[model samples]
Target: MAYPIVITPEKNNEHYQYLVFLPDFGAYCQANSIIEALRVAVKFIRDYALINELPPMKLKLPHSTGEQLVTFVNVNLAAKKGK
Candidate 1:
C-alpha cells in the first residue's frame, strides 16, 4: 500500500533537516533529506503494521506550510513478511 507522508523542513534544528509525519498513524520521524525521510517513513509504517492493525487511509491530509511537501511511500507488507 502507498501511504501518505508529510515532510516539513526544520529550520532551527541542527540534528535533522526535515520532519516527516505519518498522519494515519499519528507518528513522526526525522531525517536529513527528502529521500532519507521517505525511507525512514517506509520502515516505520512496515514495522508498525507488523505489530498493529493498519488504519484506514486518510483521504484528507493535515495542514502544511508552503515549504512542506506531501508525498506517498509504497510498502508491501506481504513481501516484507517473507524477509
Candidate 2:
C-alpha cells in the first residue's frame, strides 16, 4: 500500500541533480543520483511515519490528474545499502 514517489531533474540548467517528491506524505528531497534519491525518500518516509503516527507502507495515495507529468521512482533501501 505504499505510494509512488516522483523524481524530477533539477532543471534545464542542471540535469545531474534530482528531486524526489512524495505527494501522499507531502515530503521531498534532492540528490545527485537515483540511489541517493531513494535513500532520501526512505528517510522521509521514516520521519513522516514517526511524526504522523501512520505506518509508512500502509498508505496508498490515489493517482490524480491535473499534475505535471514526471516519472515515478522506486525506492529500495535494502538494495541501496548492499543488503
| Whole-model lDDT values for every prediction | 0.90, 0.61
Which pairs of residues clash in candidate 1, taking residues 3 or more apart in a chain or in different chains? none
Model 1 lowest lDDT segment of ten: 56-65
**Model 2 off-target regions past 4 Å?**
12-16, 55-83
- TM-scores, all models, native as reference: 0.89, 0.57
Candidate 1 per-residue lDDT over residues 1-83, each given as its tens digit: 87789999999999999999998888999999999999999999999987899887756656777999998888888888895
Write candidate 2's Cα lDDT for 1-83 as tens digits.
34567776676536458777887667777878777877677777655545576435534544544432343444444554568
